[model samples]
Target: MELPKDPAMLLSIVNMKLRDFYPTLTTLCEEMEIKETELTERLASIGYEYDADGNQFV
Candidate 1:
């Protein structure tokens, strides 16, 4: 799937996927064929970081 280019949109979509589908960021990245580091960095650029305990980015 093509990920959103905008950091804010990417943050929202990824968090939603993490919440509704994947149990963890690792799973989400694997299933989506995305690199976990890349995804996290992208979100982090926008001031979001993965909260493993909550399974979402904050």
Candidate 2:
């Protein structure tokens, strides 16, 4: 499915997937066919960065 265009929604959805499904952002991106760079840049637009230890954006 296509991702939410809204940044807040994107953050929520990505975080949820990260928390429940993926072990790492790289895995998520590869399996889900999302570009890691774009995902990071999108979240970074709203001041969220991936925290690898927690596997979530903060």
Candidate 3:
């Protein structure tokens, strides 16, 4: 699927996917064929980072 181009929207979609489906960032990225580093970096640029314990970007 195409990821949101807006960082904020990307954060929302990623967190939603993590909450409703995947167990971890790695699994989500793997299943979606996304590059984990790129995803995290994008979100991080907007002051959000993945929190493994919560399985969401915070």
* lDDT tens digits, residue span 1-58, model 2: 7999999999999999999999999999998999999999999999999999999999
On the 0 to 100 scale, the lDDT of residue 54 in model 1 is: 100
After TM-score superposition, the amount by which residue 25's alpha carbon in candidate 3 deviates from its true location, in angstroms, is: 0.4
- Local distance difference test values of all predictions, in order: 0.92, 0.96, 0.94
Candidate that would win on lDDT:
2
Q: Please report the TM-score between candidate 2 and the true structure.
A: 0.97
Off by over 4 Å in 2: none
TM-score of decoy 1: 0.96
> In model 2, how large is the Cα lDDT of residue 5?
98
Off by over 4 Å in 3: none
Q: Each candidate's TM vs. the true structure?
A: 0.96, 0.97, 0.97
Q: What is the alpha-carbon lDDT of model 2 when measured against the actual structure?
A: 0.96
Q: Write the per-residue lDDT of candidate 3 for residues 1-58, one digit (tens) a residue.
A: 9999999899888999999999999999999999999999999999999899989999
- Residue-level lDDT tens digits of model 1 in 1-58: 9999999889889988988999999999989999999999998998888999999999
Candidate with better lDDT, 2 vs 3: 2
Ranking the candidates on lDDT from highest down gives 2, 3, 1
